[model samples]
Structures are given as structure tokens and as C-alpha cells.
Target: MTQFNEDWKSDRIGSALRGENPLVITEMSSGFAVMGDTQFLPGYCVFLPKKTVESLEALPMPERTAYLSDASLVGEAVLRATGAKRINYSIYGNTDAFLHTHIFPRYHSEPPERISRPVWDYPAEHWKSNDDSYKEEQHGLLRDKIATALTQLMEEAYLEKDV
Candidate 1:
């Protein structure tokens, strides 16, 4: 086992920056795109800033804009990769408190009750269930797809800046 897999949760952003986080899908201009731990919602991902900060409001305006823009870019990539009906973006610093965004893909096939509710509204077991945990054999393809989409989007954005 790798040091990161065993203790990455202790410092997600730090490990991601070191390229030690196996969950990392790609590194964005402003952050890193990481696959969520559970697959309760397939294609679920998170955007983490380059450095640690308690909340988004703590960042300067330019950094804040980049973080937020990166979040939406991750959302769009999740949507395109997962083919979800829509994407839900969230930023609650309650747990990790590292100024990150959660990108969830909402699908039309979800139960009627769950389709409209917040991802947190789902039972807690959903977050910890091994059945829903990310497995390379099962989710690696999806992760690759999301990474590819995000990389392309970023390239396009950079090209636009040059033009």
C-alpha cells in the first residue's frame, strides 16, 4: 500500500499537490480534480485549491474567481463524462474545511425522492458503504473520461485567452 492511500485523508490537497493522491484525476490551473470516495452518485468529484484555506471568502478576488471557475469547469466535465441530467455544485467547509467544492452529477434515473434532494440528504450509510466505494476496476474508466474532458476544456480556455 502507498503512504497516500493509507493517510491521504489527513491532507488531501497536500498529497494531491505531491502527486501522491491516487484519487486525483487531473490538476487544474487553480486546483486539482479528484474522484470522490464513494460512488453513491457516479462521477462525483471534488475540486481542491492549490493551497489550504478555511473558506472561499478567504481567497483574494482573482484566486476566488479561479477557484469558482475551476469548480464549474469540473461540473461541466462531470456532466459530459457521466451524462447526468444535471450537475450539483457545493462548497461547505464544515468537514474538511479546506476550501474545496463538491461536484455531484444528478441523474434522471435516480429515485423520485432523491432526484431533487441535496446529496447530503441521502442516508449516511451511502457515504461509507463499501458497495459504493470507488474501485479502480469499476470506476477507473469514468475517472479517465472526466479527466480527459476537463483537460480539453482547460486547453480550450487557454487557447481562447491567447486569441
Candidate 2:
């Protein structure tokens, strides 16, 4: 797997969290959620946080609460955008200690990342090159969409509830 240095960290991440996808709706402090990069399954978005905080428990109380709130917001956005029957949420910090989450929209027949066995293993491919301009562009466009959606959601939430 390719390792990222501080420089990589300095560069913008989660630009995808922003856009006008049929899925993906917001970028939370703990992470952002957007439609999955691979179209094999639609409305598959990755929720990656802004900071590298490892375990969720490690976050300060206020941040922890806010993070969950954001995660839920993303979930609602995904549902609103995709009309999925259910949303699957997972947090796997194994790939990078930089805390992140996955917000997957599950249809009845989507294949499990893991099988009957609790232990799930699959082939991995590390990004071999930095020529991800397409990803960058996609991220930019998505970021705009998500931000707009989030703003609307926030207004509704704030008006309807005390939040």
C-alpha cells in the first residue's frame, strides 16, 4: 500500500464530500460522505473526517457528539438522495489511523464485503500514481453539491428543531 506523508496530509482531502451527486450530502468534521467512486453500486459514499483522530472514543465529548450528528446527517442525505431501503454505516480505521467512516446505501442484493465467515479478506490495490485529476474534479463538483444540500438541511433542522 502507498503511504502518505505530511505533505499528502497537507493537500486537500474529501473534495468529493461537497457535490451534487444523486447521493452523498455533507462533509462532517469527523468526515464527509459522498456517492461512491465506483458505480458498481450507486450511492456508495465514504465519510472521511477532516482530522486524523483514530478512535471515535478518543474525540472530545463535544466533538464526539457533533461527529455522530454529522454522520447521521450524511446518512439522512444519502437516503434522501438515493431512496435506498437502508443505509449501512461502518468505521474502519485500519487502512489509515486517520479516522474515517463508510456510508453505504444497501439494496437487497448488494454483495457483502465479508462473507458468511466473520473474517473478511479481499485483494487490495494501492493507488500507484498521483494522476488523479479526474478524482479531483469529481471531488470539487461534489463538494459544491453537498455543501448546498447541507445548507438546506441545516436550515430545515434548525428551524424545525432546537439544533
Candidate 3:
């Protein structure tokens, strides 16, 4: 048996804060937009708070709002980049004990039963299975697509603000 560096999963927020994680797509108003390690869903991502708060309620009201807004922006980016039929937003911190929002891109091409169910219901193999892991080239392409979408959206928001 091999022991992998699960450290990335353990302290994703810390890694992002340190600028040590290549998975970070961009720094948003309230958090960092990071690509998911597993590419099963293609454009999956997470919005991680800059500070390590246990939950959204732990943040100031304004910060909480910003985090939510950032999560929404991530979902929009995933949708635009992947052409996903829908996006799933979730924020359960049972395992990681950190404040983060999962932005999952749901596709119409997904198996019918899996499409309508919670993403957690998908087989474990799809979650982090070595066989289904992302190749280097796939990671670059997906990251670029999401980053481009996020940049465009941010530009649009700025223009609107200036209008």
C-alpha cells in the first residue's frame, strides 16, 4: 500500500494562502477559487475562505455575504467553461472543518440516475480514484477554461460597477 500526500486535502486553505497550491484559479473578494483535485466532473471547483473559519456563521455578516457571492461566481464560471446543464453548490465541512463551498458542474450528458442525485452519491472511484485522476494536460485545459471565464466575469462586473 502507498501513502499519498493527503496534505493537500487537509489544508487546502492554508496551502492557498501560502501560494503553494497550483490548483488556485484566482483570488476572489472573499476567498480563493480553486480547481478540484478530482476531475470526474470536469469543471468542479471550491471557494475557500482566506481565513480558516469553521463555518460561514463564524465570519462577519459582510464576509459571509462576500463568500456566498464568490461561490456563486465560481459556479457561473464552471457553467460557462464546461457548458454544464446545471451547477450544484454545497458547503459541508464535516471532514475538513474549514469554510469552503463546492461548486460542482452538473452535465446533461451524465448518467440519468447520477445527474439528479447528490454528487456524493457518485461512486467512490469517481471521487479520487487513481484511475480516474486528471492527467497533466487535462488539468491545464480545465484550469485555463475556468480561469478565462472567471476573468471575463470579473471584467464585466467591474464595468458594471463603473457604469
Candidate 4:
């Protein structure tokens, strides 16, 4: 079992910035797109701002807009990569006090009761148990899929803007 530094839980963005976190899928203009540690729901990801900010509103307007756009791009990628029925976008800084977004891919394969509930409603062990975490191989494939999807979407958006 790989042991993570205790600081990682308190400074996820910092860990990613320092190259200590292996979850990073790709870096965006405003933030980094990282795969969630757990794989209970495949393609789960988080968007973390490159600069530390207590809340979303703390960012400059342009930065905030860029972060939001990045979150949407991540959601689109997760949707495509996972074949999810829909993606859930959430921003709650109560815990970490950092400006970040969680992008969850909701699937048709989920139980009927869970399909309509928030991802948080799932078993706590799903997030808390290290045993449930994704292996490096799995993480790499998922990261590639999401990164590829995001790249395609970005290119399409740029082409549209140019036209």
C-alpha cells in the first residue's frame, strides 16, 4: 500500500501544484483537472484553481469565468468518457475553503434510488476507504480519456470562435 503524506488531505491543490499528487489529469488555463481518488463512480473529477482562493467570488471576474468554463469542459469530458446520463457540477468550499468544483458522472447503471440523489448520499466508505481507491493503471486510462475529450472539445470551441 502506498502511503500518502498527511498534508495531502489538507492541501490537495498544493499537492497537485508541487507534483506530489498523482490524480492530476491535465492542467487548464485557470486550474488543474484531477481525477477523484475513489472510483465508486468512474470518471469522477475535481477542478482546482491554480491560485489559492477562499471562495469562487474571491477570484477576479475573468479568472472565475475561466474556472467555470474549465469545470464545464471537465464535465463534458467525463460524460463522453463514461457514457454517463448526466454530469453533476458542485462547488462547496465549506470543507477545504478552496475554490474548487466537483464534477460527478451520473450513470444509468446506478441504482434507481441513487440516480436521483446527490453523489454525497452514497456510502461514506466510498470516499473514506483507501481500499476503494483506484489503482494507478486505472487512473492513467481514465485520465487519458478525459484529457482527450477535453482537448477535442477545446479545439472545437476554438474553431467555432474563429469562424
Per lDDT, the best of the predicted structures is 1
Q: What's each prediction's TM-score? A: 0.96, 0.59, 0.90, 0.89
Per-prediction CA RMSD (Å)? 1.4, 7.0, 3.4, 2.3
Q: Cα miss at 98, model 3 (Å)?
A: 0.8
Model 3 agreement with the true structure over 1-163: per-residue lDDT tens digits: 1233557666788878877666789998788999887888898888999999999999999899878877888899999989999999999999878888888999989999999899999998888797656555667787888999998887787678689
Q: Which is superior by lDDT, 2 or 4?
A: 4
Tell me the spans in candidate 1 whose CA falls farther than 4 Å from its real position: 1-4
Per model, state how many residue pairs clash: 0, 13, 0, 0
In angstroms, how far off is 134's CA in candidate 2? 8.8
Candidate 3 backbone collisions, by pair: none
lDDT of 2 by residue, 26-55 (tens): 554555555544433345566655655777
lDDT of 1: 0.90
lDDT of 4 at 145: 85
* 59-114 per-residue lDDT for model 1 (tens digits): 99999998898889899999999999999999999978678899999999999999
User: Candidate 2 — worst ten consecutive residues by lDDT sum?
Assistant: 117-126
Question: Candidates 1 and 4: which is better by lDDT?
Answer: 1
lDDT, residue 4, candidate 1: 42
Error of 2 at 20 (Å): 17
Ranking by lDDT: 1, 4, 3, 2
